[model samples]
Target: MRSPTARTAPPTRTPLATGWGTRVLVVLAAGGVAVLVLPLVALLAATPWRDLPALVADPAVLQALRLSLLTAGSATLVALVLGVPLAWLLARDDLRGAWLLRALVTVPLVLPPVVGGVALLLLLGRRGLLGSSLDAWFGLTVPFTSVAVVLAQVFVALPFLVLSVEGALRGADRRRALVAQTLGASPAYVLRRVTLPAVAPGVAAGAALCFTRALGEFGATVTFAGSFPGTTRTMPLAVYLAMDSAPEQAVAMSVLLLGLSVAVLVVMRGRWVGGLPGARPPRSGQDAR
Candidate 1:
C-alpha cells in the first residue's frame, strides 16, 4: 500500500497547463494593450523627425513650454503643501464622513475639465460671489491670468496626490509611530520624523503624477485662464492651437509631451510598484532564503 504522505501528495502542474479560461484572458489582455499602445505608436510614426528641432525651437512653442513647466511645478508644490494634511485626515479611521470627504476629493478626477473651469470661473471671476468681495476689497481679479492656470492645474492635480498619499498612509505599518508617541514624542515630532519618511515613496509618486497631469491640462486652462501666449498658454493649449494652424508643430508638441510623460513613468516605476496599494515590495535575498 502507498504511504500516507504519497497518498496525500497533489499532482504537479506545468506552467503550460493553463486551460481555455486562461487563454481567453490572455487574448483579452493583448487586445487591451493594443488599444492603449497603437495611438502612441501612430503618433511617433507620424512625427516629422527632421523638422522636430525647428518646430520645438519656435518662439511660441518655447513660451508654452516655459509656461507649462512653471505652472505644473507650482501646482505640484501647492498640492504637496495642502494635500498631505488632507490625505492624513482622510486616512484616519476615526474621522467622520471620510467616505463623503474622499468622494468629494476625487470628484475632479471624473468631472469634466470644462465643468471645473466653469465652476472656477463662477467662484473667482471678477464679478463672481467671493471674487466680487476680493475685487471690492483688494482690487484683484483671478480669471484669465497665469495665476488662473496654476489654480486650474491645482484643482485637477490635487486629487492625485491626496489619493496616493492616503493609500500609502493606509498601507504603512504604524508601529514605530505609535511607539514614538508612547515614548512621549510630540505628535508633530512623530508625524514629521516617523510617518512622513515611511510614506515618502508614495509622496514622490503622487507628485510625479500631479506634475504630469498638470502638464497635460487643457480645457480648464483654456476656459478659465485663456490662451494668452507667454502668460497662460501651456503646451497642451499650444498643441491644440497648432493642430489648426500647424499640424507638424502639433505633432512635435505631442511627441515632446509624450516623452516627458514617459520619463516620469520610467523614473517612478519602482516607487509605484513598491509603494502603491496592492503591490508587495520585492524581498531581499536573505528573505527569500
Candidate 2:
C-alpha cells in the first residue's frame, strides 16, 4: 500500500448544483408549478360539497357524461386505427415530404379549436364542399349531430396518438427487426412479431392520451356538433352550459373531469418519459449482460 496507491477523480457538480443556481432554479420552478396548480386548488375550494351528489345525479349531467365517454372512446378507437399507420409511415427517414406531413398532423395542436370546428363544418356541413354532394346524394347531414362530436374529437386527439407512436418507433431498436428480416421472415412477420412488441408501451400511452384529449374536447364539438343533451353534449359542454344557470353543477362536473384526468396521468406516469418499471426497453449493451 505504501509503494503504490491509485488516485481517484473528484466528482463533478452539475450546472444547477453550483452556488446560487439550485436556489434560483427551485424558485422559478415553484412559481411555474404554482401557476399551474393554484387554479385546481381554487376549484376544489369553491366546489359545493353538500350539493355535489345531487349535481352529478342530474339527468343533464348524466347524459353529458355518458355522451362524452362514448364519443371519446370512439375517437380513441378511430385514432388507433388510422393514426398508427400514419405514425409508422412518418417514422421512416426515407419518407418524402415527411416534415410537411408532420406539420399538417400537428396543425390541430396549435390551431384554435373553434377554427378547426369551422374547417370541419365547411367540409362536412350540408351545403359546403363535399357536404353538398353527401347531402344531395346520400341524404346525410353531419353538423349538429352526435357523429359530429366524434369527428371533432378525432380531429384534435389523433395528433397526440400519432406523435407519441412516431417518437416510440423512432427510438426503438431496429436490429431485431432487421435480423428477423434476414432470417427469411417476411416484413409483415417481422413487424408483427418483432417491431410492435418493442413499441407497445408507446402505443398504449398514445391511446391513453388520445382518450383524455377526446374526453376534454369542447369548442370544436360545440361549434360543429351543437350541444344537445343525450346527443352531442359532452362533459365540457355541460360544464359551460351549467356555469350560466347552476354554477355548483358546473363546479361538480369540473371536479369529476379533473379527477379522471389526474387518474389517467397517474396511471401513465413514467410511460411518456421512458416506459413503465417492468416494461422499460433494455439499454444499449444491456442484453449482453
Candidate 3:
C-alpha cells in the first residue's frame, strides 16, 4: 500500500465574544457614535419648525446669510489658490525645513479661533505690527471689516485644503505624472492634465470642507472682523446675537445650518468625501491561457 497521505486540520476563527480587544473596540465605537449623534438629535427635537420660515425671512437674518455665504465663498477660493501649490510642495518636494513648514501650515487647526483672531488683530489692526505700516503707507484698514471676515475664514480653512490635497497626492500613483513629464509636457500642463484629475476627488472633498468651515466660523470672525450688519456679521454672529434677543430665530437658523450640513454630507458622499470606492469589472468565466 502507498504511504498514507498526510492530513492537516483547517484553521479556526475566534468568536467575537472570546476577544476582549474586539469587545473594547465595539464599546468605544458605540460610545463615540452616541456622543456625536445625541446632540444632533436634541437640537433637531428642539427646533421651532412651525415658525422656521418666518424666522429665517427676517431682514437681519437675510443680511447675515448673504454676508456669510459671500465671505465663505471668497475664503474657499483663496484657500484653493494658495493651498494647492502648498499641498504639492508638501507631498512631492524635498524642500529644506519641510516639516517646519507643514507644522506652521497646520497650526491653525489646533489653535483656538479666538487666539488666531488675536494674532491677526496684532498683525493687521490699524496700530498693529503690519497694520501700522499699511495705515501709514496705504491708508488701509483690515480689522473690523468685511475683508477681515474673509481673512479669518481663509486662515482657518486653508489647512483643511492643504492636508486633504497632500494626502491625495501622496496616495496617487506618480508614474502617470512622471510619464507625462517625460513626454515633454510642461509642468503646468502636467499638473492640470494629469495630476489634478487623479486627485479631483480629494480636491472636491477639501473644497466642501473648507467652505463649510468658513461658513460656521464664529470666534475669529467675531474678534477680527466685528459684527457689523451688512459688513462682517455672518450667519454664526447673527445666530449669537439672535440667541440673546430672539431665541426662536436663533433656533431656526441653527436648524437651517444643521440641514445644510446634512445636505452637504449626503450630496458629497461617494469618492469625494467618502462612502465606497469604485468596483472592478467582473472576471470572465474562462481564461484562454
Candidate with maximal TM-score: 1
- What are the TM-scores, per candidate, against the unseen true structure? 0.92, 0.89, 0.87
Spell out the clash pairs found in candidate 3: none
Query: Candidate 3 lDDT, tens digit per residue, 88-113?
Result: 89886668888999999999999999
List of clashing residue pairs for candidate 1? none
* Native-to-model Cα distance after best TM-score fit, residue 258 in candidate 1, in Å: 0.6
lDDT of 2 by residue, 201-252 (tens): 7888888899999999998998999988789989999999889999889999
By lDDT rank, best first, the candidates go 1, 2, 3
Q: Which wins on TM-score, candidate 1 or candidate 2?
A: 1
> Please, what is the whole-model Cα lDDT of each candidate in the order they appear?
0.91, 0.88, 0.86
Backbone N/Cα/C clashes per model: 0, 0, 0
Worst 10 residues of 3 by lDDT: 274-283
Cα lDDT tens digits, model 1, 215-242, are 9999889889999889998999999989
Model 3 misplaced regions, further than 4 Å: 1-20, 274-289
Sort all candidates by TM-score, best to worst. 1, 2, 3
